[model samples]
Target: MFPYRPMRGLDEGLYCVDGSFGRSPLGRRMTVLVLPSGRLAVHSAIRMEQADMAALDRLGPVGAIIVPNTLHKADAPWYAGRYPDATVLAPRKAVARLARRMRIDGTLEDDWPAELAAALDRLALGGVRMPEAAFCHRATRTLILTDLVFNLGVQFAGLSRLLLKLDDAYGRFGPTRLFRWVVLRNKAALLASLRELEQWDYDRIVMSHGDIVETGGKQLMRGAFASLGL
Candidate 1:
């Protein structure tokens, strides 16, 4: 299992841990951010061994567990089992899917603790067939997204390349056309949300499935949405 480690040159409070999606071979990432109270909020959890758990403990207590991606819930139950007191938050639509396995403390729309609330804001991508929540850190000027935009630029090889191309995602830096076709129900509403996101002052982007954007994230995001003609 990959261990938790601080992301280089990012804000001191932010960290990332890598894991493979179950049986999928592709690497996935989990975002861990330390709140002002020193507690941690984890997004897209992955199973960790004892040593990694200890490492996380050294960082801070696990205070919040967020299942941001509609389909990325493999480790949520494991995290909830390990940190029973941590608040479990997921998108409204995801609640039903996850309720089959674990208890949900709240949906993204609910009020979070003051410490985290002060630093984070959740944006729900409305009018999409699959519900997803995007988060922003006010202090770091960072945006956290899941499946909205991908930066898997030139990483896959051989069969993976062909499959990604078939998936409409090979080496691309934006949402796959197939994904949009399947989930984007109201382009206007999605466009409005993207435009609102453009208004944010984020310079970095941390996405679950791709390389993080280190700078000019706003422009990158704007260009991405514009590419869809939204």
Candidate 2:
């Protein structure tokens, strides 16, 4: 397992594990949701040590594994191999790509388990080269994202910090300029999706690649996309 922090609670029935992102110190995170039925849903999974896995198992039986997008599918197979009974899920558009990495049992749009559906709201981002999905955990009003934005802060050092600074995402809560230039295909469509997300009642934002926005996330999101006139 790569260097990682042990599982820690984030909100009521919500948890996260922080770990290294490949060789970069930019970091990554895995969000864990304990459903109303006591089953666990893992989003953007990361390979963890046995102790951490045991800690996660103590929360509840792993019922679902969510690969939020193609870019975040690297660790999906690891989770699948560990929890063979867990249903692997991805966005409808991401299923085909994710299937090349692991067996995708269903899409988040239609095949999400009924028992787990009530705890969160889901959306598929539009007009991006790599299809991605976002979620809002209803009970905590936390918006969950993967690569939509980054908030690396000052934890990084040396080369990683320099690279992030070059990317214009080192110490901010916004999308990287690189992402805008490379991944985003249609600004209008992405802006439309961002507008739709504004309707969600979320105050906190938890993203895969950086620090969590504890409050005022809506305003931050708006400001982040203001350049695109959101």
Model 2 ranges off by over 4 Å: none
Q: For residues 56-143, what per-residue lDDT tens digits would candidate 2 score against the true structure?
A: 9999999999999888777889899989999998999888877886889999888878877789888899878888999999999999
Q: Which segments of model 1 are wrong by more than 4 Å?
A: 1-9, 228-230
Best-matching candidate per lDDT: 2
Best by TM-score: 2
Candidate 1: pairs in clash: none
Which lDDT tens digits does candidate 1 get at residues 1-230? 44434333367688887667655534678888999888999999877777767887888899999998568787888899889989999988778888888878888876566767877888888768888988898788899998887788777788888877887777767887766788889888898888777777789999887788888888777777885564
For all predictions, the C-alpha RMSD in Å is: 2.1, 1.3
lDDT of 1 at 175: 82
